[model samples]
Target: MLHSRFCCQWGNTLSSTLLRFPLADHKKVFAIALPMILSNIAAPMLGLVDTAIIGHLPDAIYLSAVAIGAMVVSFIFLLAVFLRMATTGYIAQSFGANDRAAQRQHFNHGLLLAVLLGSAIGLGSPWIIDFAMWIVQPDTQLIPLASDYIGIRLWSAPAALITLITLGVLLGRQQSGRAMWLAIITNGVNVVMDVILILGLGMNVKGAAWASFSADYVTAAVGLYWCARALNWSPTSIHIKFNALRQYASVNGNIFIRSLVLQLCMATMTGYAARYGSTVVAVNAVLMQFLMLISLGLDGIAYAVEALTGAAKGQRNPHKVAYWCRLTLLWSCIFAIAYTLLFWLFGPAIIGLITDIPEVITTAAQYLPWIVLLPLIGHWSYWFDGVFIGLSLSKGMRNTMILAAAFGFLPLWWLGLPLQNHGLWMALSGFLLMRGVFQALWLRLRWRQII
Candidate 1:
């Protein structure tokens, strides 16, 4: 009887302990992670919807044009994604330190940078569009349609950058729910506009662009309001210092380079896929959405890690940093496995459901296996990228990405060109593998020091 009583007491004590730490940690992570997951999922839903809608259009060119156009836009915006990354690190650090002043400074700096960069991108859209067109070698049937799509979508640069900065600040502040709210509202707006203009008004690809622009601008406004409310940062409190800007610029510059390399790799893949032909491009584009679904969903977890790691780093708490890394990696692997199985089992049905093109469906099914395998390679790099960003190890990420993209992935592509379209898939698969291995090796070595 005494022993039984002791066991009951121990069980109660263990349950209470879990209520305090590990269980609480799980709750905290999911509170932040769930909204981010939803937002991340919603952000790409527009593209999938677009591809689906365009697939049923008169010919495959509409589908191909949207695919190529979207990639061009993504590459352009990715060049500035550092705004979001830099903001994430700085804000996370500030939150950790409990320094509202510093956090406000980071937001201001990121906002200013976004404005300047957005203006530059907006102004150069024509030239940039032309350059993208040149590089992709858009055929006559698709060029005008693709050009129109780009022309309309370019207007969103300012709003998109601002939105990105807003998201960074929110995520850094652990207000991912607000971020998720913004993404949902924005995507909802985009979908309404997409349907209205595409089906109701018959604007074709231009309708899609207009929808994106309207949604982004509206969301940017919402983001600004949320930023003001959440940060309690106002014009009266805004302080800009040259030293702060310089420090931010330095970190941001390195991140920009790292992100640029990443985007270039994506652009190369899309460009080469375009070279394969419109049918292939359409199939690849649809399949690419599924990839984004997996990657971005995982990225929400990565962002959680980024925010937590930055917080821990700011507090000089090495154990916390290490804890976050382990926790994030474990969760990421679980999600990766789940997504892999999801794609493997239902990929064909999903592809067919999204489009009416039989050839596109067949081609995408053939490539689905690689997609299934990518999360294992791609998920970890994303997690590490977040962790490294939190530590402000931008140069490390930049160097590794450069090496991986240049020496690791590109060479494999060059060698595999003889395999035709299959070669491209092989190259992409090789790229993800190289990134996973390279980043994993780097993290294993540097984890002790960074944490």
Candidate 2:
């Protein structure tokens, strides 16, 4: 009889434990991730379109022009990505704490920083362009075309950064759906303008850059309106508060370090790739799209984890935070496996679809198989970035990234050089592996602190 009673109590405990899972919250999490995934996907659709449109142009000139133009712009705008990351963490935490005032304050802080940074970028465009040109050392023929594209596109830096701030603020508030809507609007307009200017008006590279600029400005305007309405901006609240600025500065300072290191790593990789001949650079450009596809897809789940974990931490619920970390890893593995399978089976056909250049197509295809390995190895840092960001451990994030970039990326790349074209692929793969391994190890040791 005692044995039977013990068994009954044990079964009851097990059942209650199973029942404690947060199904509704899990569903809500997926709801946020779905739109976020679409937005993430749409974000890269522009790059794919640019490649397709410019690839079929009269020559490689237009394609290379787009590549250089877009890369320079990406390097510039990605600095503002911290706004989104910091905002998401801060806002999610405030949401968890049920602090509406804090949310409002964080949003305003983000806007102030955005304006300050955006204005600075606008004012420095001329020197920035010249510096970028000097570093990349474009061929004589392509320099004029690239310059034209950069000149017009840099004019939109303020709008682009403003959009970054808006997206960051919205993501912080857990308004993933709204962010998706805004991204779709921006991308859709950009695509239509590209078709009109490049295809309809026969404007070539200039049209492509202008289309992007116009789309950014339009999106910025709409975003400004949405943010103002959401924040209940009245005469009393129009000016940002000093205390809010202090908090924002503290959070963003750490994140800025994190963002800067990531940017440097990316810029370093692409810069090294450019040191090779144009054929290799073109091939790397093609491969990067696939890499972006995988990373961005995985990033959806990571972003979800960031929002959920940040909120959980803010609420002082270690159990919930732990649950989210486990769930994120599980989902990440599933997506990783699915992407690997897709790339392995269809990589050649996908590469063929991007460019008609026989050389570019062949080179990209040869390197495509290596990409399958990325989903397995590359998904970890993408996920862990969100994990640390959620826990507000941005300083650790900054340090880890810098270490990985310096120790892992630079040395391996330097050693892999004898292989030439193949070495670039090997080096990039090593960089991704190092990021995953280092971040995973760090997280393993400090899981308690993070949770």
Candidate 3:
């Protein structure tokens, strides 16, 4: 559905206002972005809580084990993130076109796909878990603890995927406030569980895993309620057409490839970081949290771009689409600059809050400069991701990411082996910057055609 539209210069019916380039309304951006920011913060806030709890433990191995273990589960969940992203795009367009039926159809398709993929991941967890652990090859002391954490968390695969779809619908409909609440509630539950299981009961790594598992299921149930109420939809009305399913799958398949590369980059980063030992990997883990904060916080702007740009595209209003693309990029830059200042100012203190280990703290502080550089360097790609997702330009995303990872990050990392961790940071920064550069080139070259 999307590949054709983007490639063929979309021929959908245009609203009469298509020619009018009205002034950009900043309110529309905030209306969608603000709630998402809070919602986006919740997960990282959970990570911070998890890290803080695990970091304070007597041994660095406990912190290291949980970090590696959570990475494994995050890789799995990240792979399936398309469920939310594709649903949001499709639903946003439907909402814009005032097509209730299309919205419902997309929602149903996302639900069906979620169940199948979730079930497959659950059944296949044993092998995936083994493979992930094998790649990282953590310290022997950390392996058992990590496996226990991963093993417990993997059980929530189905609920986790379903949660993606429910949240997808909320965002697609521009119901970001609802999405925010859903994220807050979900992470709040995880936070509480972490406190009880890790601090109170002294379960440590397993406790963090269980907290995540329980929170996911709760989110799935609650998210469905929100989506159903908003859409006035129910299970009994679930009707999926073969054509619709095919389109959904096609749109998401490209996303899957892109996501696979993303997970690969992350897994490789963690695996290599593990080679340096506990303190280094723990440092990497903490730094990754800062990265997540940047990405997710910037996601507020990106999500807004996806919904509004998608809606504008659906209305066949070239002027509005252009307006959105420009202003959202402006907002993204502002946000990125803000993060750059925040990290530079308080990064060490934040790292201090996470873990009390002097070695890990010092090692992590050494990398704060890279974290400071990231928001600005990598934010363009994040902003463009929203544009691509909204426009259903997944193939472009897939190609750019593959190119960035294969030609940019991998080669640079290989060439910089002498520099060690510094090399890894350079490669990552290069990878992110390359992605944005490629996408920007594509969009710039195709501006007239796509619009």
lDDT of 2 by residue, 328-420 (tens): 777787789889998999888778877889999987877777898878988888888888877777767777887787877678778888877
List where candidate 3 sits over 4 angstroms from the true fold.
1-24, 46-68, 136-152, 191-211, 274-283, 343-369
Candidate 3 TM-score, C-alpha based: 0.83
lDDT-based ranking? 3, 1, 2
- Of the two candidates 1 and 3, the one with more favorable lDDT, higher being better, is 3
**What is candidate 1's lDDT per residue for 346-425, written digit by digit as tens?**
88888988898888888888888888888876787778788887777877777778888877678877987887667777
What lDDT is obtained when candidate 3 is compared to the true structure? 0.86
In model 2, what are the clashing residue pairs, if there are any? none
lDDT of 2 at 78: 75
lDDT of 1 at 322: 83
Show the lowest summed lDDT stretch of 10 residues, model 2: 230-239
Models, CA RMSD each: 5.8, 6.3, 8.8
Give candidate 1 misplaced runs (Cα > 4 Å). 1-21, 46-71, 136-152, 192-211, 274-283, 347-368
